[model samples]
Target: MASFPPNRATTLKAAFRACDVGPLVGADIERYYVDLSNVRNTEAIESLNTRLDFLEPAEFCSILFTGHRGCGKSTELRKIQKRWEVEYKVIYIEADAEIDILDAEYTDLYLVIIKKVADELNKLNLKFDAQLLHNFETWFKEITQETEQTVERSVSISASAEAGGQIPFISKLLGKIQAQIKGADKQKQTIRQLLQKDIGRLQADINLLLGDAFVKLKQKYPEYEKGFLIIFDNLDRVPPNVANHLFFDYSEQLQSLHCTIVLTAPISVVYSEKNLSNAFDTPNIVPMVNIYKLERQRGDLEYNDVGIKAVASLIEQRVDIDAVFESPQDLLELVKASGGHVRQLMRITAKAFLTAATRKHNKVTTDDVTYAIKQEQFNFERSIPTELYSELAKVCLTKDVPKDENGWLMLFSLWVFEYNGKTRWNYINPTVRQSDAFQEALQSITANP
Candidate 1:
């Protein structure tokens, strides 16, 4: 029997650790590797292909893509962008890049929109028309001045010499000015009306800029026939209040815009009662692709088996697993325990390979997998707060928690565990269900007075 050289296994394990989760592993590994890409699912690819076909002409459609974080929503979006780039002018921006917009006053929202549009246009290597650029600058200046006046009228302060001396000139002047402006109710009302007027003008300028871009593209490429598409991801990452205003209050303005806007927002933002007024209803307006449906299908053997095969293949690329495992079953068990979460399985298997390699083991048995599982569990627990464990326990024992009014929302949050590049809320982790630690905690809770 061929044996791995002394420390050669350790070196191999370390090398595997450095490999990025992105990119294709070898062909054999590609078959078994849990693909976080949408290409992994036939259904998803077909659905997206159909959506792309519909959007090819680009008639101002608003789409909302929602999924559990890391369930490959972003990856799918990028794939669509890549596929559509040939036909449509595609521009992608992440909403979280503008974190300052969380506390954005109404005018600040318009500024963010303009900035994103300008950035995307620049990225596409498109030159802005000098006429439109001048109009945007004039509109932006007016909006900024109007916003400053509104802020001055909303906040009041009693300026003191001691505090004034320490404050920046801008802050001090704004503070004293705000105090004077806010003292009169009529002035405050006037400021609000002026701000609203400026916002309307800003919106008009943005519409004009988009119209100009579209017309210029059509004129430049008379033979080329596709509209521009701007995709915004991580809109949900914005503050809830701002997200509500952007989607709800400005829905009509967004819908009227010449370009197709695709937004990836959190499901909660669309569903929240406080934010629901005139917001696009969850089912009706936005085209949503459900990602969870791809994990399991009709009476098929749980895809967990396929997931295991995939991870094993990926591991083979970096580790000489033949010498470590007597049979593939041992490796499969490790994958099973990982609950199909690709990242977790890779991390656990990598750690176990390192552990076994250091021990000079030629065959990693079930014991090695067992050790790795425990190590992974410990790592997971350390990262999560103890409160989460308690909440999870509540979920596991009852299988159903109280809904509506008073309930532990976090329990519902954990219902879906992201595993093996899929989101699974229905499948329970068998190891977790059977573990003594988990059971003991449940028993202790049950027995308590």
Candidate 2:
């Protein structure tokens, strides 16, 4: 744990820094990670750990890990990587960072996996079978028109010294191709037209290289008995059409790769009518931490003490809450307004801190919280469609999220909260429900229902 300076100004600055509205990775994650395995059904991570821990090195398995953006899926995945580092050569890739994620195909994913695995293996002085490399190089050159001279110039101009050594000519060419596809729409169309016909040949050659690399890796690091674990993060951000093409249209190819893999998928796909389980098995979902106590029989909701503590612990890990807030009630109000979305809590807290400082308050107060929440409410009102108000009202009253596009939209937008008690249910975001339009809509529905 990191300690803060005792000065009041320094403490407030630390509080705001701790409330950053972005994903935490590496050391920052290890320092501040909260175990929510007991809070919701986080068995997804547990099951994945067991599978990798117990499965044979030669065996291949794929799991779909999903959750709304900022629900801490990446944090939990980092935890998984840390736990399995001793046994598996974990290669974590953010798909969006590597490819044109919006137009990505299974074939593109295949290239990334093979390149990354080969690159890692090269670090061990483990070389690929010469014939396999030759075939892939020849095929890629014939298709992409990449020559030795062009490859050298591209590599020299594009790569740093460390990355330069890891990337082979084939991998360097593919990297240039992916960058072109992402930046030039016209070039993407031309490149796809040229290589789509050789997709099968491309896949076969890459798989062979992977097999050779896997064998060499085991020969070098005998203790790394479990082979490779490739995690594809941020595939969840792709548009629905692209997701369908990669996860549905080419499901067989995605799973056929010979390694234990975890792919982050979009949350909406979990609710779609498509039978994803029949192909890749049921996806593991990271639901929101249950911050509210539900009296199901009476339909009453209140802040749960266990959940409040967990959310507060997130802040307390980095900042002393008592030192930053005028009273405990102000902190509680901010937590209640967050509705258990991790990023939302950070944003709201940061806003409240700014609100207090702008007004010269010694510490954050309830008035600062109220003003901050109102600002958030206005932002939501601007984005949410007027007609969806009625559907949101129904969810608040019935506590059931309709199994359709509207429901998925609400969940995606963070306008609703999903919980698993005896079964899955949803409720309106407390802040959204406080909007004047939402209040009127709820009254109308209550009168009619």
Say which candidate scores most in lDDT. Answer: 2
- TM-scores vs. true structure, each candidate: 0.60, 0.91
Q: After superposition, how far is residue 124 of candidate 1 from its true place, in Å?
A: 5.6
Which one wins on TM-score?
Answer: 2
Model 2: CA > 4 A from native: 1-10, 156-158, 162-166, 295-300
The lDDT, on a scale of 0 to 1, for candidate 1 is 0.50
Q: Give a tens-digit lDDT track for model 2, residues 13-107.
A: 66776777766667777677677655566777777777777788878788899877777888788878888888888999988888887799776
lDDT of candidate 2 at residue 65, scale 0 to 100:
90
TM value for model 1: 0.60
What tens-digit string does per-residue lDDT give for candidate 1 at 1-449?
Answer: 12223232334354335323432222323233334333133343445456657754435666656533333455456666777777776777665554343432334333444455554454445556877777665554354363445544443354334444333222323333333333565654554466567666666777777776776666765433566767766664555456566666666655555577666654334344554434543311211112123323321124444445654554565555666566678777766665544445556676666666677765665777788788766654444445444445554544433332112232223222422223322333434544556666666666772
N/CA/C clash count, model 1: 8
Task: Look at candidate 1 and tell me the lDDT of residue 154.
Answer: 44
What clash pairs does model 1 have? 32-310, 33-310, 324-364, 340-419, 340-420, 341-419, 341-420, 342-420
